[model samples]
Each structure stands twice: as C-alpha cells, then as structure tokens.
Target: MLSKRVFSLLCVAGIAVNGIGLFSGVMMIDGALYALIAKNMVLSGNYEFLTLHGFDWLDKPHFPFWCTALSYRIFGIHDFAYKLPAFIFWLIGALYTYLLARRLHGRNVARIAVLVYLSALHLLLCNSAVNAEPYLTGMIVAAIYHFYRTYREGTFSQLLFGALWAALAVMTKGIFVLIIVGSGFIVLWLVRKEWRQFLNYRWYAAVALVLVFILPELYCLYRQFDARPAVEVFGQTHVSGIRFFFWDSQFGRFFNSGPITGHGDPFFYLHTLLWAFLPWSPLLLFAVYFSFGKRRVAMGHPLLWGSFLITFLLFSASQFQLPHYLNALFPLVSIWTAQLLGNMGRLPANGTMHRIQWYSGMVIVILLCALIVLFHGSGWWVFGIITVGVGLAVLVLTRRVSPSNTFLVSYAIGLLIGIFYGGYLYPGLLTYQGGDRMARFINAHIAEEHYPDRLYVLDLEIENFMLGFRCEVPLQAIRSEKQWDAINDGSLLAIRPEALGEIPDRFEVEPVASFGAYRISRLTSKFFYYRTRDAQLGEFRLVRLKKR
Candidate 1:
C-alpha cells in the first residue's frame, strides 16, 4: 500500500506532467467572448460578457466565468488562465475519485482509479482549454458523491452537501443535474428498499437544500424571465421559468424543439467515451471482465444501475450529441471500474491481464510504426526517430516505480503514441487535411505587426480549429452567399489554393503561405477550397486584400 504522502505527490506529479505539452491556443472558440470576459475583468471588474458581446452569451452558467475571470486577473488571460479552471476542477475530480474509490473498495483500488484518470490523457489535453464539459463533469460528480452519502449512510449534512453540488450542477449545465442526481437516486430507492423508508425526512430537507444551493440559477431565471417586464429565451418573447426546467431545457433539446442543432451521430458518444476515458481502455476492458466476474455480487449497487440508465438514456434520446456531453458520468465509470480492480485482486493476474497489457502496448507500437512508415519522404524519418523517442521516454519512466507494472508500461506507450500524433503524424500525413496552408500565408504576409481580428474562413475543416488555435485568432465561418460577396471589395483573403478554378475573373491569385505540402494560395483541395475567381463566393476569411 502506498503512503498518503506518496500517493498525494504521485497524483499531483502525474496530472501536472500530463498537461504540460498543451498550453497555448487560448483564442479557440472563434468568438471574442473567450478573451472579452477576462478583458472585462481587467477593465470593468465585471465578469459578465452579455453587454460586452452583442448577444447575451448566457448559454453556460456563471461560476466558471467568475473562476476564469479571477484566473485571468492573476495569470493575465493566457492559455494557463483559460485552462486554470479545468485544471483545478480536474484536481477536484482526481481527489473525488480517490475518495469515492476508497469508499467503494479501498486504497489500492483508489490508486488505480487515480492513475486511470490522470492518464485519461484527453481530459488534461482538452481541459487545458476551458470548456463547460470537463468543469461540468467535475461539478456533477462532486454532487453525485455527496448525494450518494445521503442514500448510503443517511447523514443530513451529507444530504445538504449533495444538494449544494446538485444545485451548482443544474446551474452549470442545465438539466443534466437531474440525470446525474435524480435518476441515480431513483434507481437507489428502487433497489435498496430501505431507501424508500429513509426518504421521508431526509428527502424533504434534500429538496430545500437543493433549492437553497440553486438560488443563483433561480435568481437568474426570476430576474431574466419571470420578473422581467419582457424576457426572451428559446425564441419565445417572454419565457416561462417552469417550462425552462422540464421540457424547455431538458426534453426540448432531445426532441429538437429548443433550437439546438448539430449533426447527430448515433455512435458519437461511444467513440467520445472511448477516447475521453482512455489510456484506461484496457482497464475498462478489465472492468467489463470484472463486472461480469462478480456481476451477481455488485449488480445491486445503486451506482451501477443508476449511472448506466441515466447516461444511456440522456445521450440515446438527445437530438444534439457531443462526446463531452457525457462527462458527468465519468466518475461513476471510474468508480465502477475501480470496484472491479479492487475486488478481483484476490484472483491471480493471468491471460486477461496480459492481453490487456499487450493490446495497450501494441497500440503504441502500431501508432509509432505508422508514424515511422508514413514519415518516409517528408524531409523526416519517423521510425528510427520515434523508436528512439519512445525508448528514451520509457527509460526515464521505468526508473521510477509504481504499482501495476502493466499500467506503467501502458502509460509510457500511450504517451509516445499521443504526442507523436500531435507532433508528427499531424504535420506529415494529415497536413493536407486542413486549411493550415492558408493560415501560414496570412501569418507571414500580414505580419505579426498586423494581427487581424476581422478574420474570415472559406473552407471549413477541423483543421481550421488547428490554425485558429495556433495563430491565437478567432475565425468567423462565412455562412451565406451575401457574406461571401462582402469580402471581395479588396480585402486580403485566405482561401484554399485549389479553389482558383472557380474564380469569376474579378480576383487574381496571390500566393500567401504553405503548411506542409499544401500551398495557401488560390488552390488546396478542389471540393472545399475550389479554385474560384468569383470574388463574392462562399466561405472564406478576409484579412487585408490588394486590388487587382
């Protein structure tokens, strides 16, 4: 067993090192509000950005803004400031996972859970950029654990604590709190019959405490809708607070009636969870094994049935789907996975363990091999270089020992794959995939002295996000035929070079920049960045153009 001090130090060290590579790109959302909230803090000392931006961007609740604004005050609104909330929130999540795991099984299992979470690399990667998802996950998990105490141990203060976090969760991301807290508790009540009898006195106070904790959201609703002389939300001139709770925010998105529209992938959540809770993928596989191994024993735990039902139904029913949407259930997932790890220790680690370890190690070999093979002629060699990189990294890691050599090996291999993915594969095989060429042209020609805030995007690709993050500039996705026309009046434009064929005789091609093999001129990819001459065409960003 690891000592408390050692465990504490290891957890902190693991998370810190995991997050170090990604620290730039604070200007990602392609909107000014990311920077504006911090700017407002410095200028007006107000964290609010509704008036700052043309519209009230109250889509997310306010606590994060206050936290982020304060971070900006101290850290000066850099990538670290934007990421500080997530980092701190993730720290809470790690600690919470430790506590939850210790409760479920014991300390050994808790260590595994912490290691899995810290290595769930995507969490730290994206969490480095302040998003509602990771923070939302931390909020809901803290709430759920506190609420769990009420049902399991029946402590009144614990019930109140649960209510507090639940209220914060509701305000943070809307009705998902109900799914995390309400649905989970319902399952508990049904499974553990004693919970029904205990619900009498405790449930009432739980409700009051929840309301008290959620007062901020309540006040916002009252001030923004109910008491307002005129209120606007969900396309209704004046919104109803009651309607907003059940159907408007919760059921509305599922049915596509509340104005949230995005391409719904039936398998979106599946893949998202795969990467989000990963590095632990092998551990998760082990979890399935352990879950089935002791299925009859742990089957009745309210945590299991409730988390599964809530997370499954929430995503399965929603019209809008995003990977991070299911983050609140992560702690439950980790806790459950931890339970399997702890209980199954009595059994010897056999083929199942080796297969899990081998498959994980194999992912590293495959990715590195792909990198080496693909790096053939691109002014670089991927194999020898990557092999050396991984070997050296492994040498450094093996020097420090921890429990589960299988996990440590997996961690080292995953690190090599993930970083090589960002540093090599991206610049190699996938460089042609995005508008990186166009971004470089604008960067060099436009001059660092001239950073244009008035940006335009003609070609839409995930690569645009890459360039936007790299350049620390916001991009405006040109939506209409008219918005395309507005750019031809002599403003410098960034368009895919291959699009030159589509030019309508009014514009001329001026070469700007190149990323890898793709040139940022009038041509890149014909379908997205078609070679076009018609200056007033669709989807492009304008910097400062020269008259032809």
Candidate 2:
C-alpha cells in the first residue's frame, strides 16, 4: 500500500498532467474574438469598450478583454499571452475553492474540493479556450469564498475582498454577477432566519465598495455608448449600452424579452449537466441524491444550495442560455461533492461507495476505449498508448486503492483523459479549422513585396475574426456588385463556394488558393466520420480581383 504522502504526491502529479495542454490548441472563434479585441486594444490604444470587426462590441463586459490586453502587452501577442490571464484566474479560483472548503469542512474535504474543481472536464476544456468563464469562474468563487469567510468570522477585510472580487466578476460579465454572488448570502440568511445578517452595516459597506470598484467599467461604458452619440448596434441605431448592460443583457434574456433570444426549453441545463460535468456527473448526481436522503441536509450550507439552485433555475428560465453560463456555480458543486465524498469515507465501508467507484471506473474505461477507437487512424499512436496505460492504471488502482481514495483515483483518470485530449487530440483536430490555414497562405503571399491595398470578405456567412487577424489587413465586407467595383489590382478576395451564386463574365480574377474548411467548434459526429473517411465539408477560395 502506498503511503499517504505518496498518494498525495500522485494526486498533485495528476493535476499537473491535466494542465499540460494549458495553451496548446489554436484559438477557436470565441477565443480568437477576444484575442483580436485585445490585439486591437493594444495596437489601437483603445482600452475602454470591446470592439470586433471594427465595430462597437457589447456582447460582454471589458474586464476579460482588459486582462488579455494587459497580457498581450507583457508577453507580446501570442496564443499563450491571450490565455495566460484567464488561466491564472482559473488557478485563483482553485486556490480559493481549497481555502473555502477547508474553512467549512477541514483539510481532507478541502483537498477533495480542489481536485474536483480542477479535474472537471469542462473546466479543463475552458482553460485552453480562454473565454470569460475562466475569469468569471475564478472571480465568482473568490468572491463567494471571501463572503462566506466574512459571514463565519465577521472579518471586515474578508468583506472588502469579497466586494472587490464581486466587482471584478460584474465587470467581466455584467449584472448577472449579482445573481450568482448574492444568492449565497440571501439563501444563508433565509435558511438561518438571521434577519440581522441583512441589516448588518458591513453588507451596506460591501455594496458601496463594489460600486466604487466597478466605476472604471461604468466609465468605459459611458464613453462607449452613453455619450448620447448614436451608434449602430444589432442592426439598429441609438442603442443604449448601459441599458443593455443592466436590463437587456441579463434580465431581458432571462425573461425572454431581450433582442438576443434562443430556444430555452426550461430543461436545457438538466441535460447539459450530464456532459459538462463528465466522469464526475454520476458522482455529482449521487451526491445530490445522497444529500436529499436526510431532512434539512441542504440547510447546512445555504450558500451552496442557494447559489446552485438560483443559478440553475435562472438559466433554465432564460430565453438564451449556454452551458458555460453554469460555470459560476461549479465551485459550489465541487465543495458539495467534496463534502459528500468525505462524509462517505467516515461511514463504515459500504456498498454505496464501492458501487459509485465501480460504475465510475467502468465509465472511464469505456470512455478511454471509445476515444482510442475514434482517433485510432489519426496516427496519434503515442496518445493511444498513453490512454491504454492510464486505463490499465485506473483498473488496477480501483481494486488496490482504499475506498477513501477511490474518488481521487477517478479524478486522476478524468485528468488523464483531459491531458490526452487537450495536449494531443484537440490540437491535431484543429488542423481542420481551415480559415487559419488560408490566412497563413495569404499572409505569406503579402509578406513577399506585394501588399494588398484592400481585402474583401465575399462570404457574408463565414465571419472568421482569426482570418482577419491573421491576414493582418482590414477586411471589407463585399455586399453587392457595386462594392465589387471597388476591387483593384492589389485587392484580395475570400469567398465561400456557396456564397458565389454566379461567376461574372466581366470580372477578371485569378485564384490564389482554395481550402477545405469548417469551424472547429462546429465539428460534429458526421464531420468526424467523414474526416476519418477522408471527406470535405466545403471549399474556401482566395482570389485576387484584377484592376480594370
């Protein structure tokens, strides 16, 4: 049997392995979108509102872009530079998760919570993707932890830190941050029936601090939209940025009254949780069920129950929802799951723990086999071997490890899978994201003395910011034949095959290159099946329109 120190060291090693692909894969659309915005922020010296495609952008707040812009300044524009800040925030979140879990449930449960938070499949996926979620997740958790510390210890410093963290979260995503961070205090007060907690002068002070910290965000918004100067937005003019930030962005979407709408079936999150929390989903579900087996069990941690349920129900009610929106609540999930696992270990050796371990082991093994089969032909033979080795290690450890440590073993398996995918498989898959490839070709051509005076994007449907950033040229949207008249001898045009309805006899152009292309995020089962069988989705062509 391994010593406790040996087991602990293995767990740490597993986490490091999971982090191996922290910045390997090429940036996807959302990631590239932020990267381009930050690149522009540094280049154009505009640090206020986010901008995309040379337009006023309002889909998200400025903190994430600001951080990325700062990272760009420090590291000089690269994929790692764009992602470094968010990854640091993600680490901060994990640290706070550990500290908060320890404060509530002691050291053992805290360790489990940290492992749960880090090894979460979606969290690992987002770490590489470099989205707002990483920043929000970190800040939200930090805020919650500090707030909870204030509630328990009545530390004024904790309250101040909590308010500051909360402000950062709000700055990152907007008003929705309140719903997530405040829900814990509201739920705790209600559960304990502590009316004084609400009336506490510190609560008011915390709010004031939050407002002060968010002044920069407000100032930026005011300069961008509230100047009373009309700006076109969402196909309309004179749109109010502050109104969108406060009302339309958060509540309007929640109540289905926003300009941006989606098919919110009320149960979208229920199904999404299954895949988003993979390898650990079964355990999480069991923890939920286990908690409900006793009366007033949830009342113990009003913070967790309040944050999880409020965020869950709010998203369920929203007209527009994405799975990552649920990320803010995952820290609570990790804490709850950790406590549940820790409690299970204290009880007499039972069928329940063994059953969970057995089933989880089987799931991991099956997933490994599936991944091996899926990528077998990709010539990632090294990853396949590593997968097999990890699978074998998991199988052996399931029987050899103590029941108390089974959860850690399961987490290691998930992390192993994450390492393989994030480090090896995903990067290999990104080669099919053809816009970046085509952009490189164009960029190389432009580097050779022939600088294109103008660039045209003829495919309205394919809006790849990565392509624009890579081309290092201003992209002009070609809307009509009248726009075609502006093309000159030094003009470059990129068009999707389907977008070109007919070839004009009068137009003289020469093809530079053509690529089989599709969005990496849009890769589906059919795409993989066809790809393994050597098929193409569509063609993207780059041409030079001759000067007439």
Candidate 3:
C-alpha cells in the first residue's frame, strides 16, 4: 500500500492536471482587465484607481487593489504576472476547501472535494480569469474551515482566523459577505443552540479579525484625506475611502441606478451559472437530487449554506447582475456535489438509466468535437478532423471500458469547446465585438496619422479599453449634449456613429475607413442602432457594448 505522503502527491497531481485545463478555458477578458488596471496603476503611479474610470470611486473595494497592485510591484506590470497571483489563490482556495472537508468528512472525501472544485467547469474557469472572486473565496473558505473548527472545538485562534478571513473577503468584495457569513452563523446557531457561545470571549477575537481585514482601507482613507484632500469620487465632493469601502462599493452596487446600468432579470444569475459551470451543470443537478434523497448535511456546513443562499438570493434580488458574480458560489456547489457523489458509492453505483445518461453525454461530447474540427477553418481540415475523430474514439473506448471515467469525458469535451471558441470563434468575432480589434484598427489607421488632441469615449463604451491598451490613452467620457466636445476643439477625434449624430455643431470629417462589422457578435442581444453623417449605423447587438 502507498504511504499517506505518496497518496497525497498523487491527488495533487490529478488536481493540477485538471486545473491546468480548466484555467486554459479561462478566457482573456477578466484577467486582461485586471492586468491592464495593474499596469496602468504602476505606470501612472496612481494607486487611487479605485476611484478612476470617471469617479464611480469606491464603487469597488480594495482587496483587488492589494492583490493586483502588489503583483505589479513585484512582477512589473505584465499580463501573465498579474494572472499568476490569481492562479496561486485558485490553488490555495482549493486546498483550504480540501482541509475544511477533511475536518468534517474524511481524507478521502476531502481529496475528492478538491478534485471536484478544481475540475468544476465554472469554478475552474474563474480560477483562470483574474478576478477578486478567487482571492476572496480563498480567504472565505479558509475562514469557514477555521470558524467551524473554533465553534465546535472552542479553539481560540481558529475563531480569530475565521474573523480575519471573513474580513478579507469583505475587503475583496463588500459587506455582502456579511450576508453569506452571517447566514451560515445564524444557521449554525439555530441548529446547535449555542446561545452562550455567542457571547463568549471567542466573540472578541472575531471582532479583531474583522478590524484587521479592513486595515488597508483605514490606511488609504487617512492617506488620501490627510494628504491630498482634493480628489473626490461618487458625487460625494470629497472621497471618504473608508465609507466607500464599507458601504458604497459593496452595498452601493445594489442601490446603484447611476449612469451605469444594472440588469433586472430575476432568473439571470441562475441561468448564467448553468453555463459558467458547464459540463458540471448536469452533475450538480445529480448531486442535488442525491442530497434531497439523503438529508444529513446541514447548514452548519456554512460553505454549503452561505455560498448557496447569498449567491442565489443576492444576485436574484440585486438590481444589477453579471455572470461572474455567481463564481464564488461554485466552490460550495462543488464541495456539496463531491460530498453527494462520494455518498452515492454506498448505494447502487449504476444501472441501465445511469449508463444511458452517460452514453448520451458521450454522444454530445463527440458531436461537439466534430463541430470544433469543422469550424476551426484551417486548411489542415483533414488533419484536424482526423485528430479530433481519434480523440472521440478514445473517449468512447474509455467510456465503455472505464465507466467511472465521468470527469474524463466531461473534461475532454469541455477543453474542445473552449479551444474552438477561443482559437477560431474569437478572432473572427472581433468584427462584432467592438473590443480588441476596434482599438487595433485605430492604432493602425487613426492614432498615428491624425495626432488627435485627446481620446474620448463619445457617450459610447466601444473602443474604450482597446484604445486604452493599444494607444495607451485614457478616453475621457464625453459629459454633455456636446458629446465628444472635449476632443472637438479643431483637433482630430474618433467617434462612434451614434455619438457623432448627437453633435449640433458643424463637423466635417471624411470617412477615413469604414470599419465594417467592427462590433457584431453572435451573442449580441437587445439590439441597438444609431445613424450618423460620416458612418452608416443600423441595428446592433448589445453584447458588443463596452463594460468594465
């Protein structure tokens, strides 16, 4: 029999192998944004970007500031360097989750939990993309693990650790963690009836932990107000970094109906998770089905309760939504799912219906692999087709011979999807995306020739980050009925067709280039259109619109 150490090493290898594939699917946008922000901060020497991008200041809290900015200082402002820290946090988060599960379940179950979290479709994707989610989640899981230990065993440092981790999570996002963490604590209290424990000395450590978490915000406030004192954010005339950190950034997003829009679809987030945690989505359903049949795990497993309730309710209740916000909840989903799947072994492992489902999934995966080969559009069509066909054949063989190869089948197909999407669909997609290519077009044709006075966004979001990255210029938001007026002082300007239509003054600029299909994407929904003199505009998809 292998020693415990050797078994541990094998589990690590398996998790890493699966994680690498998941991270590969982590598309560029979020990671790219974090990288860009860190680069700008280091290059411009402006650490207050928490307020930058036109003073929705304090709209986002500062853990990201600490994480990315620290990476910039150490790694010197490169995309890969910025993404490295997030990757590390992703690993750490999975590790902490394993420990937590180990404490409650067992070593075997914990190892399975880590593998599940690392292999989970959405969670793995988020790990690849640099966002505050993983960092915050890492800390949150660590805290949850310790907090439970502290409560059950009455340990001193464990309670403090829980508080500290919860605080860090707050710094990463906002007080929404209070919702997640609080929900878990309340459920624990109700279940255990630990009324006296609530008022015990353990409570003070929790308070101290929270205070320590927000220490960075405290320093930033004192530094900004005490030193510069002139800069302001979020219509407050003066920037109170602490207030923004605590409320405006965290809770503000919920209340924000500002010029920035918040989507109101109630079912938006739930549906989004189905995609984010792809391939795993169906398995999560199976796990949930199994959980209902076996009702032993309770809310004291805050990892399960907090993640589920807060994510489900917060996004559903929120006025604004994005798919990534649900990312934190996925680790919990994977943990519970792993627990559920592990338990399934005691019962009947398989039957005709189960085998049929597996066969159906294999068919779907094979078809997708075929489509990927077809769509890649390379002259090596014969080679690509043969390669993927062989791959599908291998998968089919594994499915038949190794019926326990559920994750292998899911992973093989998922990788094919992301590869085809990124390598093929992405480049051709710029015509509709108004993102990477728009700025490239400008840099190639516009920026060098005209010597525009300054860049402006012209009441539009397209070409914003692209121009910033490509031309290294921050596009000022056009603030008035005179949109693009800032750049219109007889100097050259770049304007989207609609923003150009808003100008009342005489502006005669010939069409230097018709960037045909500059921002058309297949995902474009809720189409918009506008007409302008220099550019012909028609209905366009909203998916191509700019976002932070």
Candidate 4:
C-alpha cells in the first residue's frame, strides 16, 4: 500500500490528466452526434423530442441530452461545455468507486480501486469522448452503493437515493440497466440465503420509486412518439417510443431484433478486456483466478463479482455489443482487482505478480512513445520531451518512495497515456476531421452577410455530423435532385471530392475552402503514418453555388 501523501499526489495527477480531455473537441460519430442533438434541443427549446437533420431521432433515451442541454444553457454551447457534464459524472463515478470499495474492503483497497478506475484505458477514453457510458458508469455504481446501504441499514433515504440513481441509469441507456444493477443484489441475497430480504418492503418501494423517478423519460418518449403516431422513425410511421424504451431499445438489441442491429461475437469483450483493462488486466486475471480457483476465496463481496459476471455474460451473449458497453462494469472490476492487489501479502508468488505489472507498465510506456512518434504533428517534440521528463521523474519518485510499488508505476503510465491522448493524439487527429475544420473556416473566415441561407451537406457522415454541431449555421442534407433543386442561388454546399462530379454542371460552383477529411474515430495504420496519411484522406470542400 502507498503512503497517504504518495496516494494523494497520485490521485491528483490522475484527475488532472483526465481534466485535459474537457478542453478537447467532441469526438466524431457518437460524441458529436449527441452534442448536436443537445445543441438542437437548446435551440429548439423542445426538450421532449430529439431531432437529427430535421427528422425524429429515437435511438437513445433522453437523460444524457437533458443533462448536456442544461449544461449548454448554463455554460454556453462549446466543446468544454458539452464535455463538462460527462466529465463531472465521471468524477462522480470515481467517488462512488472509492466509497463502495471502502465499505466492502478497506481504505487501502478503496484507494487502489479509485486509482484503477481512473486509469482504466477505456474509461479514460470515454471521459474525453463524452458519451452515455460516462453517465451510466457513475449512476450505476451510485445506485449499487446506495442500495447496499439500504440493505445494511434498511433506511428510506438510502432506498430512495438508490432508486433515483437506478432511474437515471435507466434513462441514460434503457431498461437493461436494471439487469446490470439488480442482478448483483439478487445474487448476493441468494448466496446468503437471505430470503426474508427478498420480501423486504424497502426493495419493493425501491422498484416503485425507480418507476416513478423515470416518469420524465417515459413522458418524453410518450410526447415524442406515443402521442404523435404519425411521426416516421426507422422508416416506419406510428412508432412507439414508449415501447422502444421498454423493449426494443434494450432487449431488442440484445436479441438483434432492434431497428439498429449488429452481428456479435461472444468473444468480443473477452479480448477487449485484455487491452481495455491495460496494465491491470494481468492482475485482474490473477484476482479472478485466486477468487474462484480450486481453493475458492471471497472476491470482495458477492455484490461486485455477481454484478460484473452476470453483466459480462449478458453482453457477450447479446447480439449488439460495443467496446464502450463494458465501461460501466469497470467500477466493479476495479474494486475486485483492488481487493486482490491489497491482499498480495497473503497471496503466494506476489513478487511475480508485481513484476508482471511492472513489465506491463513498461510496455504501455513504449506504446505511448511509439504512438507519439508515428502520429507526429505540431508540438509533438514538445509533448515527447515533457512525457519523457515526467516518466523519468515518476520512475525516480516510485523507486525512492516504495521500490516495490508496481501499481503506482502502472497508474503513472496510464496517466502519461491519457495526457498524450487528450493533449496530443486526439486533437491532432481532429485536424483531419473535415466537418469541424470546414465549420471553423466558415466561422472564422466567412462573413455573416455572406453566409448562406442554408448550408447543404452532400452526404450524411460522421464528420458532417460534427460540422452540424460546430457550425454556427444550420446544415441540411442534399441526397436527391429535388433537394438540390430546392437550394437557392448563393447557398453553400459542402461536398466530398468524389461527390463533386455528381453535381449538375448547370449549377456553377465556386470553391470557398477545402479540408482533408478522415474519420478520426476509425484510425488506420495508413492514417497514422504521415507519409501515407494524405492517401488515406478524402477532401471536403465548401463551395458557393449559382444557377447558370
């Protein structure tokens, strides 16, 4: 275990690194799309309905958007404002992680759990990306923590708070959140054979409170879809947002019967955990092995293990799965891993585990260094120098303070990776994201008087969505001749290089600006290498149109 001073300093460093992401641009696809929706909500002043490209958008539930829109209202719409709420929620998660671990284990274990949760690779990335997962991560853990308190003390306030957090989790994602949140309690009760607890009035009251608290989300869905049956969504009219919320949004995805579907592999998260858990992965494996191996031991409380295993199994079985889906589980995983790490004194071959962690930290440092070299951009040399200096400082500090503290070494490495990502890698990559660049150019260079009545996007892509969020003016999609004919002279059209040929020759076009566009989220080796990056990019142009 690290001394109090050392632990405090490390925790501060971890949080400060995460704070760097608050200033980074909203990521493409999910992050930008969510920001755009929230921006539209603020503009339209209709918080009930979600709209994208002027159409009813009905994939996710409304809590995250409401939170973000409120942030926008208070902070004003910008990158930092958009990311601030989610970042705060992530901090909430860190707090709950500490509290829950301390309750189940002890102060030392709790401290380590918080560090592990902070440094987990995907959680770090998700914090910067600013998505639904960050919200869920905090809310779910809070729900579990409060519910545990309710179980122990049988207090009304604890039950109410638990339900409130659980309700928020449901609204953030869908009803499936209950499965992740409830399964642990069920398992814990069953294992303890506490059948009387099952019939406890507090448990029943919690269910009712959760339902009551979620009425806002239900009402929004009702107003948006159920009340207006004529609204077309997913290519069909008379869609029920209420039903989607209760069924299709979560279970439908699990069974691959939802409007949005994907083929899934059971082994997806299995391999994903290997990297997503980073330097902690080996220790987590050891944790699990020691907990459940031939000689079984308690893995913290049954609450943590059951919650993690049940959710992991369900996600693996579900047809719709993404890497971020696993993020909400990290808090529990962190606690379990931390408990094991703290108990290294009793565990045999602890030195071997520490050495493994040390080697893993070294590997991560090498990878981060290599990433800086490969994706060399402006200020790359400066970032490299600072990273090297920090690495050396941490090395000397850890050796002098606690020579065997591999966990600290891992945490420091994780912070370095996060700094490189938030400060250098992601921002540099955003330059290739054409929509934001084009929006910036128009905002800076294009005069308000010269601004087009409507800016049309040639295709609906992630970058274009980012443009929609960042652009001062509204963007309309142009997919057909009729839409093109609707465009007035002097209106601007943002077109991809390949689609430029599709424009009618009769519409005389003058280029205003061109930007190299790439899907920054979907990075490739070619894009990472400067020599081949141009080949990987497609050009997006802002052009003025006039009828001939």
lDDT, residue 435, candidate 4:
89
Off by over 4 Å in 3: 1-36, 49-56, 127-129, 218-244, 252-266, 295-303, 352-357, 370-387, 390-395, 398-403, 411-435, 438-454, 480-492, 503-548
Model 1, range 1-548, lDDT digits (tens) per residue? Answer: 35678667766657655455345333234212444444444545544332222223335556666676787788875556766776677778878777777776678777866766666656644454346666776777777778777767988888877787777677667765666667766776676665554547787787777767776666655565566536444445666564565466666677777655555666777777777776666666566665566654233246654766667676866788866566666666776655554444344453466456656565556656654554442534644576666755654554433334555565556555545543443334333433444555556655654655645555443345445433434455553566656665444445555554544455555544344333222232232222331232333333344446
> What's model 4's overall lDDT?
0.86
Distance from true location, Cα of 281 in model 2, Å: 2.0
Task: Give, for candidate 1, the lowest lDDT window spanning 10 residues.
Answer: 527-536
Looking at model 3, how many pairs of residues clash? Answer: 4
When 2 and 3 are scored with lDDT, the better candidate is 2
Model 2 reaches what TM-score against the true structure? Answer: 0.92
Worst 10 residues of 2 by lDDT: 291-300
- What TM-score, computed on C-alpha atoms, does each candidate reach? 0.72, 0.92, 0.77, 0.95
Query: How good is model 1 by TM-score?
Result: 0.72
- Best candidate according to lDDT: 4
lDDT of 2 by residue, 189-300 (tens): 9978999998898888888999899999888888898884587667777778888888898888878787877778788999888878866776677677765665232222
lDDT scores of the candidates, listed in order? 0.57, 0.75, 0.57, 0.86
For model 3 the local lDDT of residue 10 reads 50
Candidate 3 residue 129 C-alpha distance from true site, Å: 4.7
Residue-wise lDDT of candidate 3 within 1-548, one digit each (tens)? 22468546755654554344332322334444455555566666777554333433344566676677787788764445665676667777888888877886777657656666665555554544446777766776777777778878987778877887788788777777766655666666765686886677776668677887677767766566535557644334565666655665556667764424476688887788777776567666666655556556411254475457655877787777877677666666767655654554443443432454356556655665555454444433653575477556646655542324554455445554444443444433333434444456656755456646355554335444444444444545555664534344444344566655554445554444434334332233222222121153232111112211
The best candidate by TM-score is: 4
